[model samples]
Target: MSNSKGRHRKEYHEPKISEIEKLVSSFRSAHGHDKLMDSLRSILGEKPKTLHKAKKEDTKGSAEPKISELEKIFQHFKEIHGEEKLKQSLNEATGRDNQKPHKKDKTKEHNIYVDREIKFKKVKSKDVAKDIINTAKSFYGFVREKLKYKKYRYPAIAISILMGIYLLFNLPLLYMRMNWEKPADTQKLIVKTQETVQKKMADSATLAPGEVVPAESRLIIPKINVNTPIVYANTKDEKVVQDLLHNGVVHYQDTAKPGEVGNSFITGHSSNYWWDTGKYNYVFTLLDKLERGDQAVVYYNNKKFVYTVRDKLVVEGSDMSVLAPTDTPVLSLMTCTPPGTSWKRLVVRFDITDPVFHKPETVTKENVVEVPKEKEKKPGLISRFFSFFMPN
Candidate 1:
């Protein structure tokens, strides 16, 4: 019985030598006796095991990691928690209750992707659309009420149309009438007319042989306050006549000379002549306003002939009797009446009371003296031979 018991004890018990040798070798390798004893106890399956001895050995053997490394670990944990909390908040805000909690690695890698995906949701129909529509309707209703009570539609349209018409037609007329007053000084008018006519004729060189007479001439009517330029009527050239008539030039066929004693009859266009700014539109409008004593000047041949506005008559355009030759030296200017109509002509007859003449000398070869030629300078004998004296 004793031998059986001995054999059972031997089979159950661990050999202390092998275990102690292993513990000593481990202590030598780790350079710590306490950690080696703890390791041995753990291998032996000891209850209530503690790592206090191992921790003390570790502290005595090696230095701790740096503060920066410890901080990085702490920050890593904080970022993990913060990201988790943010994801929870985002899911709550977006009403995506069915969203799954992402894995740590995937969450960190695709955080921006998740945010963008969350923003892609369609707006629900129940959110503020009705309020926006109601606000628009309210604004529209307010506008309708204000405009409805004003009752200004018809008056506004009428005023707009009337203003347009006035701007289109009457504005220019009003402007012309305002600026169409006669000057107070009468002598200045005569002087100005004479000077203008003389300059024109001198520039034209009318006395030169074969010189064509200018189709257009200027005239000043001090009585009717007309200072516009006029042109003569040419039988072959209608454009000059048309332009002259359009710009208030009176045409005359009866007088041979500009300041002749025979009856000088002239005709001009009315507003019926198509022009952007028809000069004849107001030609006859002021004719009736002329007085009998007022002076009328005709600019011709660089001279002015002064006449007194003696008689004014509104006659038919075909009145050949009115345009007949008269015994007195008369100046007659006729234009279409009623602005745009040619049914009647306004005839302004005047008697030539004063005549001003200006005679300018002719420019001829006899009067023009020749200038002398310059002598050439030579550098060598050959050049001197080539150079010759020339006559002046």
Candidate 2:
């Protein structure tokens, strides 16, 4: 019986007293001597009064005795609970060793996540660029294969080149038109130009009865930044009017003059040939920017007439009804549609403010907004060139 008891003691005491001292030293390093004493007191189930007395003694230069008390407590717990159980209890009581593993685990997970995100972003960007290049190559190859036959090859290539050239010439003009800004002095320019025209006409007041003001007429539409002369053409012939457009925007001879009791028809080039010999070739390029209630001021015959836009329309180039007479006085402004092409006509019609031309119709069930459908018409190249000067 005595030999069996000694063997049991040997097995249970495999960890020696030195191991206990080392564990306490490491605990003290991790949590400080004060926390180590508190944890030891907690594990030993010491009374709060006794722990308080010990802390007061520690402040009185008795720390060595307090450490000895902790050592004695450790020895007692070691014998009662076995060495392994005592070590486990110490780790639980200190808590730093258990918490260290969790912190390391969290740091490792964060590093892995960040690395994966960086690698995925780099790979995704490369894949996207490669896919784009491959798609463009495949499209090019497919088009080339379809046009391999002699019958289709030359026409396909010619059309592609022509379209490219057209875009190259027209895109800048379109951009300029879309981004055009009104200058700060645009209003001043309008007032000053009208005054100058009036002063000129007043000086030439001693002319014949049928003579008009000496052709110093100006047209000012503030919305599109237009301040250009109004060119009067004697004839409605397409060729003659086209020639007159080089000087400025043309007013049809048959149409009513500004402030007259009829439609005052005016047309200008939205965009002309690249080498067109005039500053006003691109004057009305942004005419499409006008909306209802916008203003169009015409300085003519020693007078200034301000017209407010009432209706806007985009009609086929072949449509002549827009040029017909109206029951009320109106100012009709015409420009080639889509800026650089003569596909259609964008008309901005305005009601004369003086002597109030727009008679308000009573609101009815039919007064709901109506959107007009655009009619498509493909004018021949000859008509396209003369579309800017279309007759009233």
Candidate 3:
């Protein structure tokens, strides 16, 4: 009994959770992102390092590897638990003692995960806590590896960044895709139905003018392919007023409707947060792309009112001239100056050129006049060189 006691006599140290947490907090501040990534590299087997550096280090130094996050964590643990306890854990984890061949098979993994085939040595509760810290450290290392600059060397990180860049560069195309005006099949059907209705109508004047303009009427632009609803906002409520941002195009309730004699003032979001949701959000993002003589169609009360864009005006956000009453039967389409900001407003005035009751059958596509955007002729070398320093 005395000899057995001599062989097995020992007590291990336990670590304090609070102290380690404090250490982690201090480490996070002192090292910041860089240290965090370095620690992670060690945990993930230092993938960023080259074989040459590894061989040089191996030849130059003893068998001792670089200090792992596990060691750093355990160093703190030892201060709380005691040197004896820590040493015992280290010895148990990696023994310098004589080999004792047993029933368990070690894992093929290079990392610390003990293979299922190998049975772990029975350990004290303190050792279990150490294992948890090691696990947490490994997780931290993985995250740092993902975000660090050195991560670019890895296939996964390189591929991911390339993918992200691809997405970033094609943002304009993606925006167009997400906000496509209508479903493919539905849009074709609408055009087809309109053609059928026009063919069935005997006389141009007999075709009914579209329905009465409502609070949530849809405005369609065939050229730019925009189809957005109109939201009416005449109140000063912050929430209600901001609704102009999300609602496709907002119309002043005091303004005239589509078929009225006065100007119909309608505005929609041009530039705002990319993630913003609202049917009208970004409805007018491409409004600036419209050139003079382009067509705009307003659908109200199940009837269509046709207008031709005649002019464009860029003004300060506070400018109220665009909304001022006008005797001419006009439709004003408004949006922000920049596609994603609100520094200024863009107003496009469209005249009611074609009557609402005009049947489509009366017109041919060739006869309909369209003003194409004028292409800017490039200046000669002498002109361009001068223009580089001063506007031409």
Q: Tell me the TM-score of each prediction against the true structure.
A: 0.33, 0.37, 0.36
Candidate 2 lDDT over 1-392, as tens digits, reads 98986886666554444556666666566446666767676656664333433333224332333455556657666766676787676666456443554343656644654565455545555576676565566556556655767887998989989978886877766455444433432111111111111111121113336744434798888878998999888997999998888889999888888877688999999998888777788988998888888987777877667789898899999999988987566899999999889999999899877444444344323223334334445554545444433532
Candidate 2 wrongly placed segments (more than 4 Å) = 1-215, 355-392
**All models: lDDT?**
0.54, 0.70, 0.61
Per-residue lDDT for 1-392 in model 1, tens only?
98986785565443232332333443435444444335434433455344653233353443333224323332333344454543343234323323479665745544544443444333324656665565556555544543454475566567879878865775666445444433332221111112222211222222336644434466677656677676566553546666666666656544544466467777665455355576565655566677788876666766556678888888886787776776456778777776677788888788776643244334323233344334334244433323322111
Which candidate gets the maximum TM-score versus the true structure? 2
Residue pairs in steric clash, candidate 2?
none
Q: Which candidate comes out best when scored by lDDT?
A: 2
* Model 3 lDDT tens row, 1-392: 87754553333234455543444444444434345445535543456342222222223324223335445566555555676765555444333222477643334332344431122343325676676566566665645544554544477677879988987887776555444333222111112122222423211112346634444578889887897786677774646766675756777768888766688988777656657666666678789999998988787655567789899989998888888887566899887888877788899999876564333353323233334344445545545444433532
Q: Estimate the TM-score for candidate 3.
A: 0.36
C-alpha RMSD for every candidate: 34.4, 34.2, 39.9
